[model samples]
Target: MTQPSDYREHLMAAALFIAGRRWPVFPLRPGGKRPALHGEASCPRTGPCADGHRKWEERATTDPDRVRRAWSAGAFNIGLATGPAGLLVIDLDVPKDNTDAPDGAANFRALCERHGQPVPTTRTVRTAGGGTHLYFTAPASCRLHNTAGKLAPLVDTRAWGGYVVAAGSVIGGLPYETVGPALVHPLPGWLQFLLIPPHPVVRARAAAALRNAPAYARAALCNEEENVRNAPVGCRNATLLRAARALGRLVASGDLSRSAVETALRRAGQTAGLRDYECRSTITSALNWSIAHNSGRGAA
Candidate 1:
């Protein structure tokens, strides 16, 4: 039998399935039943841990029939993983029409308004037949853990609350739809760029490199990759788009070598007075702390 400690790791890791990369942090569900699974039938109203250790029946294939049923009924998201105490969900909510974007637009708008941040230009995306997805170009900081307590409230699906961030990966939910591009706040663009990388070196390099690329593509590259494909896009700036672009330009223009770009990025990070290095270091410490203090529960 797996010890409670082992189960704890499994639970957190599983919860992260939805919240880990670009998903919201799985907030605590109400009634002490853990977070509710999105899209799937709500957990039987009894409570959490009614069973010694809540466990989900392993499925060879999550029912595609369920997904079809969900889409027809206007489900915005689907459940990715579920167990006795908790579940992970992703957006599958489809758009109402070609122009009607996914629920992500509404969600992001709501989140930004709540936070007093300016709303960005948005578009609807259709993922699979599941539903439309709204894309937002906020900041890379948006993807990290909900540090400001802004995300938890939005995602909080207290048992009685009757609201849920739809769960499930694109694969589980029949398929995700592409509504359009997510909204991007009309900032100086530099703000959006700088907030991207938690890495100092990458941030500096990307900052310098982006100077020469097409402005629209540069911004789109930063926001589009994560919002659209959910791919990291770049290593430091959420992926390597800026760094790679800079290197490519350097190679083409013969202005600098790849090694020089790297060195400049590092130097820029240190002298640019950006906090990517500091923030990255802090997050690394927090991760280590989280690992060290395993509480045998879902989240610390």
Candidate 2:
């Protein structure tokens, strides 16, 4: 095994190599997940701009020079910014202390089977802690959020607003290794559906009663509308689609008119900063899917 001191040069070389590939990279403290910085203050106390021990996500950079400087001082782990680099990582965590935990890989396979999709073989990285990171390209229209134990026990996702330590990074004298192809593949569509599922359409009561439905139903609709209206860039289409689908359920139950749903979705998408054409296309597609799947039924 290479001593920690001996790995500095190799780490710097790897950092430069990753940056050369246009993947934003940052430094993590030696053998730790925290950002590696000289004197940067942590966030909340000093805000994210102080540069003192700042979050790796905020400091991740694609500039080769910046990456070189980050690894020049000493040994550091490389962090990959997922969303900015258009990457998504599925982290299969194996419990270090528990011996009876279910195998994450097996669980992942079963999940794919349940979804009727093949497991994606992408860029796989073996983590220091005996876990795995499966890297894939982010879908063009969907921004997956990080969630622990969402897909299966100990299965996590790292995408928008998240980061993953690069394969060459070392922790506790153990290095992350590439166990699969070097290239990151695009996310499979069926897996994408499982990850970012459309909102469920609940059964509606009488159309006249729906107009005077309980406060909860109205609140749910308002929340969906707000989600569309406040969606950030890179996520507007998905948010708009969700909102439109919610409205479509209402339309299916005859609680809302199709034209009303379309107009509302268009307005909300526009408010969320989508272009006219994008809003129109997304709303049209979402309404079509919702109406087709939800026709003649209030429950989904």
Candidate 3:
């Protein structure tokens, strides 16, 4: 049986090992995955925490001295900051319950088969719960973000704003084990295509009715659709709201049928990269408010 001290020593060494490979690692709770850092509210307003409560990702360090100092404090697990490390890890997970559906690995395999390509080997880790983590080097030009089941059923990707439990980290008495070579290859082109955000299809089938509306309504439709599609990442919801409210007047005045406007706007919202639920709720609420405020049965 390993002694507690010995386990901790090994974990410290493991932290140094990954740091040597340029992965910025932060401390997690010993034998668990949660970051062991102090929260923002508990800040003493001194040291590095003095400036602000830096998240584990912000504080994740590649410096050997810091790694040694942090690990010397406790038998903490390792949380590799994926974004800072320039990693894109595709996490293949097992089903939560007993089900006949294919597990993540099999589904990923099927995805590869459909593309007529083999799984690209990289730095892989077998997670504690029998899942697989395939590590790849993110492209220099593209900044990928984490996604849940975006690639395939049960297959997720962690990039910016996420971290993965590093090898030698223990969870539920099972250590995350490295199963593949150390070399991290460039992301496979096919996989990259799947991970990249789809370009907005400015004129999808649902937006076909945009052409069928009256000249004024068509002009409104085109202007609002362009606004939604061109809206920057942070301003998407607000732009959608404004677009919905602007078009809602035409809908209320009976110049445009409610169904046609709603349908076109929904399509426009989606192509703007808003999620389905966000599109529905924002459009519905804004349109309702505009209709309630505007009084007309036909165009003025």
TM-score of each: 0.20, 0.64, 0.68
Question: What order do candidates take by TM-score, descending?
Answer: 3, 2, 1
Q: Against the true structure, whose TM-score is highest?
A: 3
Q: Stretches of candidate 3 above 4 Å error?
A: 1-3, 199-300
Give the lowest summed-lDDT range of ten residues in model 1: 152-161
lDDT of 2 by residue, 152-198 (tens): 77788888888888878888878898985787889887667657733
User: In model 1, which runs have C-alpha deviations exceeding 4 angstroms?
Assistant: 1-34, 37-63, 66-118, 123-134, 137-194, 200-300
State the RMSD for candidate 1: 21.0
Question: Between prediction 1 and prediction 2, which has the larger TM-score?
Answer: 2
Question: Which of 2 and 3 is ahead in lDDT?
Answer: 3
Model 2 sits at a Cα RMSD from the real structure of 11.0
Number of backbone clashes in candidate 2: 4
The predicted structure with the larger TM-score, 2 or 3, is 3
| Winner by lDDT | 3
Error of 1 at 75 (Å): 11
Ranking by lDDT: 3, 2, 1
